[model samples]
Target: MKIAVIGSKGLPPRQGGIEHYCAEVYPRMVAQGHQVDLFARSSWIHLPWYQSCRFHGVQVISLPCPGKRGLDGLISSSLGAIACLGKRYDIIHFHALGPSLFCWLPRMAASAKVVVSCHGLDWQREKWGNCSSCLIWLGEQVAIRCSDQIIVVSEALVDYFQDTYAVEAINIPNGPASYWQSDPTFSFVKLLGLEPQKYLLFLGRLVPEKCPDLLIQAFQRLTSTGWKLAIVGGQSDAPAYQMNLFKLAAANPNIIFAGELKERYLAEIVRGAGLFILPSNLEGLPLAMLEAMQEGIPVVASDIPPHRQLIGMNRGRLFHAGDLESCIQMIDWAIQHSKEMKKMAQKAQEHVQTWYGWDGITAATLRTYESLLCPPRSKVKPATELIQR
Candidate 1:
């Protein structure tokens, strides 16, 4: 089948869950003899060599877009929809609510079946202004009403869509890195003077919704110890909030700011961490949390549904969302109880491996596509069973 993917920043994705998800799932789809064309924003197409337009087996189409924060997706998706109108693709898959705003254009213009993957409720994010949030809400409505099929990354979202819009969506959660381990002798961690299991790690974008400041504040209130707090992501959509996080961390020497780690270093840092913490107030099955759990790192997260779903009672500790006292208590408990945390980490890793495999994600996505293309004759593939809520 011929597929055109939209809504991701680019291929070989360095940032965002949707981009990383596409990077993992599409390659496997291409390997299975499907032709996939990905539309990337021109600003994110950094490599000079990639200007010729191709990555992995997927065709990369770089389109110029507005450099503004919120306008990027709008402009890119608009151009991608225009291009798809002529390309005659079997499926035009849109990722995230922002880009799904344009899903109707292709659905109305072409015979291709339109598919929109709602990674999260973008409107709820604090980074977007009231107008932008309203626009995103409109996007969600369009995605539900216009698309032939809708894929949700979190089960909570399934309940949300049903309750609010009365729309049915297939739940397919995000997958983690398959069996990754950090090298103890990794140069990046060594350069930073970070020892194995001696620091607390927080990985993800620095945004208001993510609540990085909450973690920094909680870390500050904790009694001083040998352990350090390593923040492992760069700013995204919320510069002021990022600045506040940096300012809060600046007051304490124990807090180390390590911006936006990539691949080898990312895994190494996560593997070396004594504990992983995510204080996000909102999430749709965070990939960072999954990645950390897959690395067998014990976690302490905000008590949101998605976090609770991944880090069950047996796996890790959870504190009430946005509650400073609760967060501090959990962090101290996790730090003091080293042996128990390790046991919890092992349980979390086992759970992640059993459920969130990349191969399983790819197969399920393909099944969704096949069912759309061959509705009457398509047989349910056994791989669909792998994605158990």
Candidate 2:
């Protein structure tokens, strides 16, 4: 089948969960002889119109984003969709809600199937404001209502749409990277000046919703105990909040700030960590947490539904969100019970192997697409069963 994926973020996973989803899933589709096209926005230092090119097998189409981030993400993505109007394809899957404006393409071409995967409601996020905020919220409601099919990553999201917008969704957990261990000679550690077992990790965007400050506060509680905290993620552009995090970190010498790590170094740093934590107050099945768990390090994440839905009691540990005391308690528990944490890592690895590996995710995603296309004629694939390696 011919497939077109529209999202502001492009493939090769330059950054973020949506990119990671596109990078992992589309390739698998290609290997199975399906043609896929992805729309991405490229930032040019001087020139305009950074065009599309073939990588591996997927065609990545790029357009220049007019403004920075939130504006650029919503605007450029809509432009990309507008550019792809009248395009030939069987399926047009949108990775995020902002990009669902691309569904306008299907209205122009009858045979094209349009889908919007609500990765998360960015409108509810702290980044968006009162003006564009309302616009995005309105856009999201319309996008969810009109799309041919809606895919949600977490059960909570599925219920949210069903009640709020009366939209039924196909539930597919985000893919997790397979477990791989470096032979302890990876140059990533020495380059970052980090020592294994000496530091804790917080990996994800440093944003208000993510509660990076909570992690910093928790790390501060452990300063006298000689445990260092390494916070790695991209800038959320909240200058005031970022500075606040800095001030909090500065008061504690054991905490280190390693900003914005990309693919290889990211996986290496996470895979080598003694522990990985997420302090998100709200989440829709975070890709970072899954990536860490899939990498087989022990996890102590916020007690949000998405994380709970993924790990439950056996696979990992959780603490109450936004509670610095609980965060500190979980951290100390992880440190004191390092051996139990490793056992939890083993359980997490087993869970990942059984469910969330790339193969399972890709198959589930394809099945979702096929079911949407075929509907009444389609046979339901069992939840755990998918085409295997």
- Which candidate has the highest TM-score of all? 1
Q: Name the TM-score of candidate 1.
A: 0.93
| Residues 153-231, model 1: lDDT tens digits | 8778888988988887888889885434556676688677777788989888888788878888888888748888888
Worst 10 residues of 1 by lDDT: 46-55
TM agreement with the true structure for every prediction: 0.93, 0.90
Candidate 1, lDDT over the whole model: 0.85
In model 2, pairs of residues that clash are: none
For residue 97, what is the lDDT in candidate 2? Answer: 71
Off by over 4 Å in 1: 46-52, 178-183, 379-384
Off by over 4 Å in 2: 44-50, 102-105, 177-193, 382-389
Give the least accurate 10-residue stretch of model 2, judged by summed lDDT. 42-51
Taken over the whole model, the C-alpha lDDT of each candidate is 0.85, 0.76
List model 2 lDDT by residue over 1-389, tens digit each.
88887774665666667877887788889999999888777762223475777756988877777657576677667766666566677787777776675566565554767778888877777866777667767668667656787888888888898898777787776776543455466577656677776678898777799998988877866633756778998877677888888987786666778898765667678877888888898788887777777778889888888888776867788899888998888889888898899999888877766777778778877877788788998764755565233
